[model samples]
Target: MSLETIIYIIFAGIIALLLALFQYFKKGKNRSKLDLFFSFLRFVTLFSVLLLIINPSFDQIELSIEKPSLVIAVDNSSSIKHLKQDDKTLGFVKSLKNNTELQEKFNVNIFTFGNQLREGDSIDFTDKQTNVHDAFKALSQIYKNTNAPTVLLTDGNQTFGNDYQFVTNSYKQPVYPIILGDTVSYTDLKIQQLNVNRYAYLKNEFPIETILVYNGSERVASTFVVYQGNQKVYSKPLNFSKQDNSKIIHFTLPANKVGVSAYRAEIKPIENEKNTINNIQNFAVEVINEKTNVAIVSDFPHPDLGALKKSIENNEQRSVSIVGVKEFVSKVNDFQLIILYQPNSKFKPVLENLKTLKKNYFTVIGTKTDLHFINNSNLGYRVDITNQKEDYQGVLNTNYSPFYIDDMGFESFPPLLSNYGGVQISQPIDVVLNKSVQNVTTNDPLLFTFEAEGRRQGVLLGENIWQWRAHSYLENQSFHEFDNFIGKFVQYLASNKKRSRLNIDFQSFYNGNSHVIIKAEVFDKNYVFDTREVLHITVKNKGSKTEKTFPLILKNNHYEVDLSGLEPAEYEFSLSTKNDKITKTGSFKILEYHVEQQFLNANAEKLQQLARNSSGTSYFINNANGIIKELLEDKRYVSVQKSSKNTIPLIDWKYLLGIIALSLSMEWFLRKYNGLI
Candidate 1:
């Protein structure tokens, strides 16, 4: 406390005593010393209350010494267990745990990891997958603030994640990686990767590129075969010397059938080749014979017509035909979707045809658009145009959830040409993009959609979408973002789907190594999305007759469950909720694919490279004990001192309050007993 505060407290005490004397002291009667002492006690009690009203507090300092953390991370994947090095690894862990030198200096944290990270020596090396990036990420989070020195023990082969070398830079601690595999050489011929599109139109040809890598081959000759199911479609001879072992072979396959096409690429294993599992790779593509035709009807020529046409044709399964109003009036019935740009009196016949056909379509209302006719039409929206033109940018609405987008480049995209208009949206609709005028976000809808009379309808009250596409390409060096948005917009408008209260989204098939996720949306009686209901799913393997039930957890706008850990087989599932009695059933297939088994040998060189990148050295399992000696002698590793501050309030002392009450009671009882009154 300062001197000024002390002086104030003393002044309060004196004033309290003076007030007590005036209130209780007798002027004409002789008072005993005991009576005077009783008056003094009352004064003190009042003075204490006055002083404490100032609310005094104090700060207490606490000091602590934290030893450096030494993390020992072990690999717990099938590759390590296959090498039969579990005994050696366990012995090394035991030695580190019992080391006295490390115990005196550092706090040791041991962990095991494969597809995931866990604490302690509870690793049986049974984890089927290895994700080295996840292990590094987990360690970085756990020991980021400490003076951490990481010791990694693994063969460093990652099967289900990005390359570990790319993810190594995120962890800042010194990485002392131990190479845990033999340096033996074996002949290997493998299909490194296969690149092909996931969808192809029937009666069209698609290209496939295969990368083949081989070692220990001296003028090897092999036959590469491509099989479509059980039928062999392409066979070619591959002859190369050992020096030119890596080759990329390209093949054009025909899509003749309208179904799921599963193809296998295989190379016959040579003699003494160790990893035969990697010699073949299987992939499937969906082939569709039915193609949706889109018709673009415009009264006059516009740049947006060409841009929109090209965007829709990005997908080979869809084709766009641009025509004038007269041509579209004759052929509008042929296209599933019709796009009208600036529909005016000249296109009145086309609009009437659209209403008669009752098909899905969209209208782009610009300055030249006939606002009077659109307002009177049954397009599910009403717009009041003021004949004022403005330039507005497209801003993405994050809450829109009809489909998924990789990214929305709204910040850097250019503005679109729009008119000053008043718009209102109706039922069964949502805004996809909002408009921003002069960089200020507004509630005006740039793009909105609604389903009416079993037809999907969309409205874009703007123009010059070609400028947006050009801006995207200039900023991102690609037109993917703009093209994707426009393409999905047309695709959604063309879809003929009935509204359902319970809807589920999942793939028909998935590879065993891929993560299997199923998403569902539930709506209430009002037909609005509601996520408060409970949904349960029962999945049964077709072959084993075993079933399991899992409850869906509420995610951001829907319910979801991860079934990635399930076995590879065809399974049937049924979903039910407590709020609704209706049950939905579906089936999916898990392909028999094990990517980890293809990595027959361990990868030791990558571990050494990672250690060098992190300013540390690599060591073998036999020399892992040197870590303790190296850390103990290093000057950079030392105990860190930490200080903490705390505050305490004075009002919590209940004993002091009790003492004041006791003094007042004793004074009253003594005065009454002695008849001092």
Candidate 2:
């Protein structure tokens, strides 16, 4: 087939030719007529032996017709164990065992699937989760053999990934699906949505919103209670409007302490049902009291100052301070945000340091600033008052507003800015206004906002925001709206103006190793943890998978991890824990040298799918007595057929042995005849 092999054959033929010629000449000289004939025969035999030495072989293989494999997929989910469904699956298993005709024709393998695949024996359907993807995966592995057809028996309830059809289609085997059990109408109630603030003040009320849904059921009045441990902090009556609808229940519960708080809302069933866990879902929200201290710096204390302070006081969590600009600049970084009230004309000297607290500063410009200071503030944008009315009534103008002390804190709201021609107005189109402000038109930049360095900055060009409180108090409205606005503005300006990032201290996994690796990510408030890295890790505990310490790794805006060799078990890992202070904690499962075999094969459903895909049958031991029968009854399982001639090459013993015997005998006879023994 190759040039080198051809050349080697030709060279061997040349050598044989030379040897034959020499033998012919030498034998001719010494032989008589009768001996010449025998010698010629011997020469022919030698030529034949030389040709056979090359060693060529040809084989004929006989094959039987391939039949579709019977894939016996069994559902091992808890639902399969339902009184009626369990009996059905059991009966089917028995039927398969008795059906000898079907057994003899198809190759059968048993498999069971639920959350994962269980080979050999079917998993008991005591587990509560149904996973159909596992069955498909199990059958796919068997279908790779390219000889067995797959048959599946399932109710077809999927509870896992979405690639079932894609994986099954890989093998061109026909899937014989056996529908099991009758489909029952399922009506359920569940906690559809929940909202909680992670950081709530200690001993203060925290607002929570919970949405409850009732599917396939009519409207019903229900009671929902919030429980903190054994204490029932709050409860309320909830009434659903109709079937396929939901009700939103709002609660304001007091936090007694500053730490992690576990809360659960229990919904009493209006209609008794088989399943109740779905009716009551438990959710945990951490109640943190890590509030930032804020200091407000204004040129002079005004009438609205008391109203602004009163709102934050009601919160009982935040501390607010009012000070002059001179004192604030001396100790600026001590507080979160600094509110400037008509700051001194020469505030430019501290602009660089002011930028350091970009999200931390809120400037409220008054009518006192001269034209020189207003035009040359060096604050990125200019703030100028084009109109100033002596007297004004604070009438409601815009219902929507997007302007806030901290732009990064909350989502944008509807336009709330309006023109108050009576107030000192900065005529421009890039501003937001509250509804209480005077009405005007166009995209006016009455306020310019930005966050530079670490502070949230805003410039309110209007002088008379305090008029809102004065006007509201005159109307006997209790100044609630004014207080709300000021409190929210202060909170936004003072709050942290950065994204959440994971800062891992160090991590470790133990496998008889005394020392552990410590790794961490270097980040600022603006950076996130997401990447892979190798660093020093620390170890804790006696080295068990159940309680191991692997500090979180930070790379590319995510926490990184590599638990390849961890033992098989659930591990509770944390990052940056000192004196029981855990920065973060998550659960991870490591099985079988971290190869994921335990997880990959944990669901019986996947195993059944793999078998079905390979044109083979999956089975379960609980009803596998018919496996032998199925194999025997398969049409392809007939007696082995043989060919007339050898299907495979065999040794040419007659020719080989004869050559050896004759060569040795001739040598002996020649020696005897020549008397040279």
Candidate 3:
């Protein structure tokens, strides 16, 4: 309230009081104590109402006490037990949590993490992977902008995820990392890496690249062997004279058998090597008798050729060859399916030969494509080209189904360049993707596939597929969406199988470290998704002859089962339905490989780097008691001071209305008692 406003309010109260006194006490009639009190109540209520009309606000200061948080983050991964330090690490964690001094100074929160972070003191050491960077990142997120000091404990041997040094430096806190495990390197012979294709054609030669690493022994003399089952296929002598050396071995093996075959590459373990689990590694490659050859016949080189080729080859059963117009005539007969890229003026002879062979083809309509010529040829569809070119994106057609790829809803992906006019289809076309122009979805087919008069054809009305693949990766952090789209198209064209109500698709082989997933799609007789039933699958371990049955769960318009924790062995699977009685059978092999055991020595350098980056100190696990004493003595990481202010309006106080009502009620009672109504 200002001085002028306060003076006006006081003068108004006096005038209102005089009016009330005059109205009630004129000629001093009925002038009793009760009348005087009634007069006083009327005067007070009128003055308070006049003040409320002014509506002033005032600031209120509030005090609060906030204790700074202290985060004790511990690594509870399987690597601790593998390094023979689980008992000591557990004891240290228990002691830190029960420390009275740390509890009194700040709110100490204990957390355990491996693949993800969790709050607790239970250290089970069962996590299969360790990610030190994730632990630091989790702490930073939970204690953001607070005066928090984090204590990290680990052997610093990160098996997965990015380097921890970056997160520790950016944590904005004092980090004290208690280094565990033996820092000294031990004598060991390890298979550092085994790289092989997951699938190969029957009777074709495939290559396996193996890198053998030796660290401790100066003279590493051993025999390297590659075998499948009990039969050894290849053997060589390995020798390293230096303390550290990486020997690369490449094996060209013939895929003789037609099934999932597991190959083991091993180095004969030395007598003094303490850790020999990493000496052997298993990898599998499925050899299939049926190989689908797909050729990309192009007039000129475009980046789309490379993108399409990579995605098509993701299926081991399919092989892609990029053939130019000059060489395509001789190579077209070798391919089961052909992808014609803008059949230009030079493709007249090629198109005639394609019709003679009666082979199915997928065509792309580009700027240079002769739409008029294509209209004459029977590729199932034609487009009218104009001088003006427009950019268009794909809008998925919900009803199209020769084979289905997962849907990508309108999410603002980059557009493909098309001629301004549009496409005109004269055949029975199953349009999979429509043209979405300027945020409006049109009925024009961007891509379609149809089988007409014993000829199967697929076509898309755009180019720049390289950009589509790159955009798919940016959208979902993987090239799976683009690859699935291409793979389904190729599969539909390469094989003319009778349609089934139930279908299952999975890899024939998988690395043991990766997640083993089997996907399924079920449709009713009307060809719509059948989502009202539970699909059961019986999984049997080939070696043990034991079986386990589980129901596949539906997600994202499909059914999938995650066989993650199954043993590293060959497994046979059978899926079944209830009333329909539909059954599907398949088998897959899981290769045995453990990446964590390759390292025999603790990574002390990374732990030391984290300490230096965060302005803290490092200590061995046995000498880690200094961490608590130093943290207590350091005053830099202490509680913070904070304050807040708020402004309150007088109208918000409902008790003021209660006071007015009470005053009016009292005035009424007093007047009635004094007979002055």
- Judged by lDDT, which candidate is best? 3
Output the better candidate (1/3) by lDDT: 3
* Runs of candidate 3 exceeding 4 Å displacement: 1-68, 116-122, 134-147, 167-173, 218-220, 297-301, 314-316, 323-331, 342-360, 365-412, 419-462, 471-485, 578-580, 644-677
List the RMSD of every prediction in angstroms: 5.4, 20.7, 4.6
**TM-score result, candidate 2:** 0.43
Q: Give lDDT for model 1.
A: 0.80
The worst-scoring run of ten residues by lDDT in candidate 2 lies at 592-601
Instruction: Tell me the tens digit of each residue's lDDT in model 2 across 296-403.
Output: 666676754565566665554567788775676788777766666666665654455666545367666555544456456555555434644332222222211222
Q: Would you list the C-alpha lDDT of every candidate in the order shown?
A: 0.80, 0.52, 0.81
- The C-alpha local distance difference test score for the whole of candidate 3 amounts to 0.81
Of the candidates numbered 1 and 3, which has the greater TM-score value?
3
- Model 2 CA RMSD to the hidden true structure, in angstroms: 20.7
TM-scores, all models, native as reference: 0.79, 0.43, 0.82
Q: Highest TM-score among the candidates is held by which one?
A: 3
Report residue 677 deviation for candidate 3 (angstroms). Answer: 7.9
Q: For model 1, where is the 10-residue window of minimal lDDT?
A: 398-407
- Model 1: per-residue Cα lDDT at residue 325: 86
Worst 10 residues of 3 by lDDT: 402-411
